[model samples]
Target: MDEISLLEQGVSFVLHIDQHLFALVAEYGAWLYAFLFLIVFCETGLVVTPFLPGDSLLFAAGTVAGAGHLSYPLCMAVLLGAAVLGDAVNYEIGRHVGPSIFSRETRFLNKQHLLKAHAFYERHGGKAIILARFIPIVRTFAPFVAGIALMSPVKFLSFNITGAILWVAGLVSAGYFLGNIPVVKNNFSVVIYGIIIVSVLPVVIEFIRANLKK
Candidate 1:
C-alpha cells in the first residue's frame, strides 16, 4: 500500500483497537497471542517498521485481558518476550551492519534520527535503553544505535530486560486497571489518541528545542 494508505490504516487500527481486539481474539483464539507477539517483535526489531503500533497495541491487549477475553499473564509473557527478543535482534543487526550504513540518508531510515539516538545514548548512558522504551521512534532506534556504538553486551542486556519488563508490564497494567473505568471506556478512542500524543510528545519537544538552538 502507499504511505498515506498505510498511515490511515495505522491510525484506524490504533483508534479502534478496542473494537477490533475482541473480535480478533475470538476468531483467532490462541493464535491471537502469536500474532501479538509478531506485531510487537516487528515494531521494535525492524528499523523500517518502527511506525507499527506498539504502545497502543499493548494497551489494547491489556484492555482485552481486563475484559476476560484473554489471560493477563499469558499476554504479558508473550509481549514481554517479544519486546526483549526484538531489541536483541535489532542490536545484533546494528552490530553486524556497523555504523557505516547510517552515514547516508535513506527513504526508510534518517541519519538525523541516528544522530539523535546517539546523543540520547550518550546523555543517558545505559539508562537510555530503559528511557527509550517509553518513547516512540526513539524506542525503535535506541537499541540499534546502542549496537552501532558498541555498548557492552552485558550492560545492554541488563537494561534491555529491565526496560522490557517495566514498559510491557506497566502499560499493560495501566490499561487493565484504567481501561474498565466508565469514563475511559466510553471515550477509549480519545484515550488512544491521547496515548499517541503523549508517547510522541517528548520527540516533539526535542525537535522544537533543537530548532531553537539552531
Candidate 2:
C-alpha cells in the first residue's frame, strides 16, 4: 500500500485499540497490556506490517496508567522490552533472510527499495535505530533495513536500547502528564492526532530541509 494508505491503516488500528481499551480493561486487563506491548513490537519490528498502532496506543496506555487502572511502571517495562526485542529480532531476520525476502514477487516490497533502505541504514546505521523512534514508516522499516545490511549487533543494540527508552519514556510521560487535564481527559482523540503529528514531525522536517538545500 501507499504511504498515505498505510498511515490511514495505522490511525484506524490505533482508534480501534483505544475504543476497545475499556472493554479490554474490564475483561482481561493484564493480557490486554501484553497485547498492546506485542502490537507495538510487531509494528516496529516487522517490515511487512505497519498497520499496528504505536504512538497512539502508548499514549492511551499511559493515560490509563495515570488513572491507576493500569500500573504505569509495569506497562513501561513490558513495552520497553517488546520494542527493544522486536528490533533485535527484525535485525536478525534482515541479516539472514532479507535476500530471500527480496527475491520474492511481493507487490509492496522490492529488492531495489530494500537496497535503498540498506544503503540509507548503512550511512546512518546509528540513527537508523535511534531517530527511527520518531518517524512512522522509518521506525517500522529501519530495523528490517539494518538486518539487510547486516549491521553490527553491538552497534545496533546500543542505539536500539537508547531509542526504545527515550521513545517509550517520552510518549508515556506525555500521556501521564497531559492526560490529567479536564480538556485532555475529555478530548482524548485530539491527543491521538497530536501523537501522530509528533511522530511524523521528524520526517516532515527532514523533507523540508532537503528541499531547501536543493
The prediction achieving the highest TM-score against the true structure is 1
Which run of 10 residues does model 1 get worst, by summed lDDT?
A: 98-107
Pairs of residues clashing in candidate 2: 94-147
**CA lDDT of each candidate?**
0.89, 0.78
Tell me each candidate's TM-score: 0.94, 0.84
| Candidate 2 local Cα displacement, residue 109, angstroms | 3.7
TM-score (C-alpha, index-matched) for candidate 2: 0.84
Q: Which pairs of residues collide in candidate 1?
A: none
Which digits, one per residue and each the tens of the lDDT, describe model 2 over residues 1-214? Answer: 8999988875666655455676788799788787877888897777776646788878877877887778888989988998998888888888887768766777765455455456557767578778887777677778888777777889889989999999999888787777767898777777777777878787677668768999
Per-residue accuracy of model 1 over 1-214 as CA lDDT, tens digit each: 8999988887888899987888998898889899899999998888778788899999989998998888999999999999999999989988988477766667778667677888888888899999999998789889998899898999999999999999999989988888888999999999999998999998899889989999
- lDDT for residue 154 in candidate 1, whole number 0-100: 91
Clashes of each: 0, 1
Candidate 2, superposed: residue stretches over 4 Å from native = 1-19, 102-104, 108-120, 208-214
